[model samples]
Target: MRRYLLCTVLFFTMISCVVNRTVVAKPILFDAEREQLTLEYMRDRYGLETSSSAIDPKMIVLHWTVIPTMEESYKAFYEAKLPNWRPDLENVSGLNVSSQFLIDQDGTIYQLLPETTMARHVIGLNHCAIGVENVGGGEGLPLTRKQLKSNVWLVKYLKEKYDIDYVIGHYEYTNFEGHELWLEKDSAYRTVKTDPGEHFMKKVRKATRKLEFKLVPEK
Candidate 1:
């Protein structure tokens, strides 16, 4: 009985270590009305069924918030209901853009929205891509190594949970514009993106190469 107890204790210690390695903050759920807007956007923009707000996500697009501080970034997202002064996006959803996840410079991860739910982070590919936004990438506030490591952890977690097909930086999303993945209604509504730089993408792809994501065909 003592030997069996020892084995059980060791087993639980390993499980505890595994969970500690990939620490994530509890999600702050959005109100029903905001989620409803996401559902309506998916249907109206992509002509998808409204049975659920969860998207049939196939890709993961990484981003960086140009906003300098974490506090300001959270406030911006928390306060805004509709996108301000963006006339083109108003027709798409009129909703201020958000991501499924956001990471702080110190490597803390937070779920801003449900994993499968669509948030308007990327154009043309929002219907099929999940966005992961990092809290810094501005001139004064660059991304950190901690953020990169945490991203790898989070991406691995997501891969195990979903059939994730492609992982790309926000800039690379345009490469899929002509592919079947592109589903935006207004052709001219596209915006250029450079968030989550090439170096960051290279690091993530290298760490996650075993996941076997599909290539974004050349334009």
Candidate 2:
């Protein structure tokens, strides 16, 4: 009787671990300066009105920072306004664009902003998606295997924590047209974007599958 009871307890514990559930880690908070800047920039650039109510993130969007270092990426996103070079950013910021997370080439993941907050990484979907930006993917510094591995781990971690329904690359976001999560300002607001390309997304999705997470279709 004692042995049967012990086995039953262990079995239920294992079952509980396998169930799909939302588990959130305490979000790493941004400094007051960056936090204020991001909030203002989102309002000015996208005309988005954010609130504590915007915490139900349903997707994870991946990006590559053609820039060299994480610090440079941080500075770009740290400003209160969008920069001029990216005329596309005229509405987003005068300093630099921002994402919720920044992953370095070495696979170091930095939480630039809170997970529950909105990031300006994607046009219409930023309100409901979490963005993860990688350090380098430009002319010389191609994305590395380490970066890929890190992304896979990060995606799995997020899936286990959120009621996430989809994992997508920044390039594929446009295909989700008319979906409930799609939110853009106007037809002209749509612009072509290809970052952290197809091969990378494939690897991440493959890794995520091993953990029993579902991939959103490439529409």
Quick one: best TM-score, which candidate?
Answer: 1
Per-residue C-alpha lDDT of model 2 across residues 1-219, encoded as one tens digit per residue: 999999999999966744532322223334565456656655654465663324478899999988999777777776545655678657544434677788888766777777777666887777688999888885677888978877876787777788888888889888877777765646667778778888888888887876664555556
66-121: candidate 1 lDDT, tens digit per residue: 88777766665663366464566676575677888888898888877778777788
Alpha-carbon RMSD, each predicted model: 5.2, 6.8
Question: Model 1 — which ten-residue stretch has the worst lDDT?
Answer: 21-30
Model 2 residue runs over 4 Å out of place are 1-53, 92-96, 211-219
**Which ten contiguous residues of candidate 2 have the minimum total lDDT?**
20-29
- Would you list the C-alpha lDDT of every candidate in the order shown? 0.80, 0.72
Clashing pairs in 2: 45-91, 81-93, 81-94, 81-95, 82-93, 82-94, 82-95, 83-94, 83-95, 124-183
- Work out the TM-score per prediction: 0.84, 0.74
lDDT of 1 at 185: 71
